[model samples]
Target: EPEVTQTPSHQVTQMGQEVILRCVPISNHLYFYWYRQILGQKVEFLVSFYNNEISEKSEIFDDQFSVERPDGSNFTLKIRSTKLEDSAMYFCASSVGTPKQYFGPGTRLTVT
Candidate 1:
């Protein structure tokens, strides 16, 4: 089965810098999501996108965060400014209008 893939499995950045986390979701999936797990915490939803537009977003997805489907196969999350508190493992998920979601290995972001 095809699975989601993310780039730079581990990323280390300085505080106040910009970072873009990339993902290629399953080809047939119609919905894509960005989630984050802050080390010991549970996975938290940040944003969801469909048809090249945002469908929903959590409060955590502030003005600093943005999502885009730059091309047919690529979906991305951009953090305009990284903060120490934003350090976490960011996951990309996709589903075909179902509760079950396929998640990528995740990009571990470390902000100093």
Candidate 2:
């Protein structure tokens, strides 16, 4: 079975530093998305990408954030600056034009 893969599984950073989270989605999936769940908070959508373009984004995806498909096989999320509130578990998901999305194990970010 195909599955999404994420790297570094865990990250620890300073409040003002930058961080890049990486993921590789299922090979045949068409839509990709990024979401985050702050500790004790609900999972929130951050952005969705398809056809090498952004399809949708939430207010949480501010100027400080960006996503890229640097290689056909890999997707990345970059945060220009980190904050204490940025500590959370970031998930990467993909779907083949369906509401059922397959999610990665998630990368937990811890900012000090």
Candidate 3:
């Protein structure tokens, strides 16, 4: 089975800096999403993209954040200016509907 891949399993950065997390979503999948877990918090949806546009987005996906399908299989999340509150595990997910999401191990962002 194919798997979603993320880079820099761990990242440490000072607050207010820019960070771009990369993901290679599953091939042949149509829906993509970004979710986060703030330490002990539940996985919360940030955004979902389909057909080249945002299908839905949660309040957590604010102006400071952006996502793109830079290429066929590459999806990227960029935080223009990170905050201390942004420290969390960012997971990239994909599904062909039915909401059967497959998540990457995640890129743990640490801000200070």
Candidate 4:
């Protein structure tokens, strides 16, 4: 079966550095999204991408953030500058026009 997968299951960085989180979603899925969970906080949507352009984005996705599809199979999220509060679990998900989403295990980002 197809599933979303992410790299560097865990990452630790300094507060002012940059970080790039990578993910590969199910091949047939058309919609891709990035979301984050700050330690004890609820899951928050960051952005959604489709057809090589951003389809939707939350306020949390500020100028410091960006998303790109480097190839047909890989999707990436980059944070221009990290903050202590950026520590959290980031999830990548995909869906084929369904309410249901297939999610990756997630990449844990920790900033000192």
Whole-model lDDT values for every prediction:
0.97, 0.97, 0.92, 0.95
Clashes of each: 0, 0, 0, 0
TM-score of decoy 1: 0.98
Q: What is the TM-score of each candidate against the true structure?
A: 0.98, 0.98, 0.96, 0.97
lDDT tens digits, residue span 1-112, model 1 = 9999998899999999999999999999999999999999999999999888999999999999999999899999999999999999999999999989999999999999
lDDT of 3: 0.92
* Worst lDDT 10-window in candidate 1: 47-56
lDDT, candidate 4, 1-112, per-residue tens: 8889998899999998999999999999989999999988999999999999999999999999999999999999999999998899999999997879999999999999
Give the Å shift of residue 80 in candidate 2.
0.5
Worst 10 residues of 2 by lDDT: 1-10
Candidate 4 or 2, higher lDDT: 2
Across 1-112, the per-residue lDDT of candidate 2 in tens digits comes to 9899998799999999999999999999989999999999999999999999999999999999999999889999999999998999999999999999999999999999
Q: Each candidate: RMSD to true structure?
A: 0.6, 0.6, 0.8, 0.6
